[model samples]
Target: MTTALAQRPPATAAYSPPSYGLVDRVAGLRHHSPGRLQLILTTLLTLGLLTGLVAGLTAHSASAGTADLGNRAQPLMVEAETVYSALADADTTAAQAFLAGGLEPAALTQRYDDDLARAGTALTNAARLVPDDSDAARAVAALSTGIARYSALVATARANNRQVLPLGASYLAAASQLNRETLQPKAQALFRLATDEISAGYDAARSSWWLILLLVLSVALGVALFWSQIYLSRTTHRTFNVPLVAATGLFAVLILAVGVLFANQRTHLDSAAQKGSAPVTALAQLRILVLTERADEALTLAAHGSADKEEDFERASGAIYFDDPRLAYAERFTTTLKDRHEAYLTIHGQVRKLDKSGDYDGAVALAIGEQATTTFGDLTTTLDQAIDNRKAAFTDEIGDAGDGLDLLSVLGPLLAIAACVLALLGIRARLEEYR
Candidate 1:
């Protein structure tokens, strides 16, 4: 204690723990038969485990995405479409009522009211699906705010019309302008977002990279199992190890089954996109265009500005006439929509002729007459049915896509573990003989 530093044992080398060189150890183990068997066991087990994990995870993800496609994405798009269509229909109906001088037709009034009600209900439903503070949410909010202002304008228009005031036409025109310019565009934007989500969802649900990875691992393990068998037969002069053989057979069967299921899911996903969402989108756009045309037709007469700036209507009609572009994407109700649309166009021509000939009252009668309403109603009903059919197709295909996925999610990993255990047992037996 008097001179601890001097008395202290001359500083020995600091205590150090042994450190292994992992690569060197691995190198030492790879040269002999028993060491090789151990390495093979480890490699095969790792591959099997990886394959199992990827397969299980991919199956679960695909199943969930497909379900969401059927449940959330498509339904939200349909709701947004309903909002757009209903708003345009309401505007068209309102314009028609305006054209009928005093005390508008009860039927027209009723239809107009129903259209607005439908729009409001659909907007609420859309709000449920859209995330808050997103573009879709903003659009929904804008639509909500605009509707009240639009309705007030319509009410003012109606009041003035009932009293034979010219200002009523201006108000009706303003309301229509607001709907066409502000509200319908927002609804369409919401719809476009929903459709874009569907497109991206299909790619995510496919999980193609995971499928390829699982496939590669499965094949590598299978080849390793084969090579191990061959090496054992050459080294031990034995034809087969029953456990290893059985394990190989099981692995093959699992791969085949999973491959079949993966193929089935991909097929269903493609069909859902093609026969369902694609058609649904094309038809929705066509229907929206038709509604716009109807609104413009009534607005044209009401405004009395005298020139046909119906470029939108012309483009829509040309697509209908050529049977190309929009209608080409969806086929079921093409004939019905086209026939009704053509009939309406012919009637619209007569309405325009009467107006140009100075038979203004007669033009108004034909424009809001039973013929026009029936034609429009027929086309609308048919389009609705077409959309419903496509939606059902989407749901059915998505349902098919999800089939067996849940079972595979659990079963795949279990089979992989079982095969790994069997292979390990066979290799360990060989190693024991050496010991």
Candidate 2:
């Protein structure tokens, strides 16, 4: 089959037209058409993101700060109390030994001496940790003087008793009076100050909890606003401005993460306080109660055995005033001391009976054997056990509290960085859609 070939005319030289006259108009229309809404949204989102991120970081920092106070400040305060307690115990023991009229049993006397030395050393160490020149510091200084005076009086009493002089009872009475008047009130004041410090720490921690919730709410609202913009632009067959979406998403994630971490830290701190620290405090109080009772008992025995004027005995054995440090810290001590005291009274009754029957040696033996040897020592050991147990509990909980806060401290900043990066990527992708 023969096909007829059609010749195509040569293509006319391509006609060049002059560039459009309204170039500016075309450019302006392209710039103004969809850009206003996109620009507004993107700017709003960016500002919102920035606000959220800043607030989130602030909240996280606050939470960490509160945790630190709880962990560091409160523990130091507790340690101060421990040192004070040890000092009081030492002073009480010394008074008891002085009451024995002659030099006390070598071991008992040594304990009193050692305790005094330990208390002095402990006070020095505690001073280093305490915030300088606070009420706590003043109290510690007062207590140190009281302890020193008490020790000197006890020594004088011992020297006089050794010489078989009437001065012995007077010296013993002075030592006990010093303890009741000067040292005990200062110690109690220190304890109260420490308690206030810890309570303030707890308040700071609790306050951060509300901040986390507010941060979360802010993040949620920012995210939802960004999402609404995205939906509107997509249904209209346009890309929502990339910067706005990116900024919003970045901040939303940052704030959300911060809020979550802050909440977690708060919970951890609260748990530590409730389960570990609170129980320990309760146990510590119980131990203090027992020790106070023992101290009172020793003082009672010393007063009874002393050969002195009735006024001397009354001064030596009088009630430890409400302002006394040990007495103040242990308000329930009176009841606890009384409870333990009945046993000592029975021994006292026996000692009196022996004396009435013209058995001076037997009475002395009974007083030393029953009252000094078994009951007082046993109760002191129990108190020590309780104190040690609670201290351990507080130590363990502090570790956990630290771990929880450490995690929270780092997580907020990391998430915020990630959110910013993600938002930037999202915005870049939206920008490409327009092209």
Candidate 3:
């Protein structure tokens, strides 16, 4: 059997898949027709850049917040504490010298001078750190003016006391009033402001949820790209795409590392704020209260018949001993303070009674002589010990917080860059197969 053969038809033109030059491909991207290889490349590149940018920005913010918490906020708080203590001690020392009459010890005189100088320096330093338009700056300015007036009043009181003038007591009382009513409150406000700033830094550092979300998106994109490579391999009958695999693995590792580091930093910073900074602030306020009470006691002695000073003392002491909720955190410290303060108040009552019963000499002896050992002296001693303990605790907690953030700032951006580069290389390698 013979089979008949059919003639082939002539082809007019060889059919070709659409081809694009570099410029055409670039233009096609804008027009949304850059073909599969360009689209994949562009998507991978864009994702990598976005992921890297997010990581870098987040890392920078975290680093800045951490730095402020450790360096600026803590130091400002310390300086504020110094300012409060120095001003209070100066007032206390001046009163003691006044009570000593014209025979004021040379050591007490030197101590008063030193305290004033230290307070002045600390205030200046704090002012330099704060914004010029801020409330802290205004408070420092007010304090500067108040301290000058205070010095003049104290000097006048000293001169009058030397000449055995009763007006000396009035001048001392005025200075103490200026401090308790105006200057001390301003100082306290400044301290509170500094604590607020530290709290803000902590909040900023803790708020990394956006970064986490970005990481999640990047991870999801990485997984998708990785599976796309698997799809490509299956369709092309290839074994693997090494670059894509590496990119995915690097992204996974980077995200995991960032999450862990961020979590740890947040934990430590939160602990510091809760256990360290907050308690220190409370203790500092308590210290201010103690100093104010001490100053009031002395001023009342100077004022003699004035009920206002005594009332002020009662109110101030009541705020700390009975009213403030913050003291609940340090029950032991608060209890110790209460006991010492109650004993001091009892001695204070006896001193007042002696003065009122026509025993000026006895009142003076009880206030500044041997009887003071169980009253003002005991209260100050216990207060000092408590302050020291709180300070030590603050240091330990803040130090631990700082230690936790040591590695994050450097590692975060680096991993991000690595992930970005690997992604670009992976997509480029896949695209080269088409070429």
**lDDT, candidates in the order shown:** 0.83, 0.57, 0.71
Q: Best by TM-score, which number?
A: 1
Per-model clash counts, in order, read 0, 8, 0
State the local distance difference test value for candidate 3.
0.71
Q: Per-residue error at 18 for model 2, in Å? A: 45
TM-score of model 2 vs. true structure = 0.67
Candidate 3 segments whose C-alpha is farther than 4 A from its true place: 1-34, 163-170, 209-213, 216-220, 223-227, 322-335, 356-358, 371-375, 403-407
- Which candidate, 2 or 3, would have the higher lDDT against the true structure? 3
Candidate 1 vs candidate 2, lDDT winner: 1
lDDT (C-alpha) at residue 435 in model 1: 85
Model 3 TM-score (2 dp): 0.81
lDDT tens digits, residues 1-435, model 2? 123223533344222222343554444554653453355445444545555455544555555555555555556556665655665676566655664546677877787777777667766765664677888778777777777777888888888888988788788778767765666666667766776776677666555555655555565646555665665477456566454455456555656555565566566666666654554455455445545645554554555554323233234334323233333323343344444444544665576677657676675566557454575565455445544554565555555544544444455445545544555455545555666
C-alpha RMSD of candidate 1: 5.0
Q: In candidate 1, what are the lDDT values of residues 1-435, reduced to their tens digit?
A: 669766755445322222245666777888988888888888888888887778788788877777778777888889999999999999989888877777888988999899999989998998888877988889899999998899899999989988889898889889988998999898899999988888878877887777888878887888888898998888885799888898888788778878888789999998888888888888888788788778777877776655354666677566554264544546657877788888889998898889889898888789888898898889888888988888888889989988998888888888888888898898889999888
- lDDT tens readout by residue for model 3, 1-435: 123222422343222223335557566664432255566666666676666566656666776667777667766776787788788878877877787677567877897899889989999888877776988888889999999999899899888878889888789879877876787778878888888887787867655665776766677667667766766577455677677667677667766766776776677776666556766677777777767776777766655555536777777777674334654445666776678778777887887789879897678678766566456666666666765665566566555655534455566556656765776676666666656
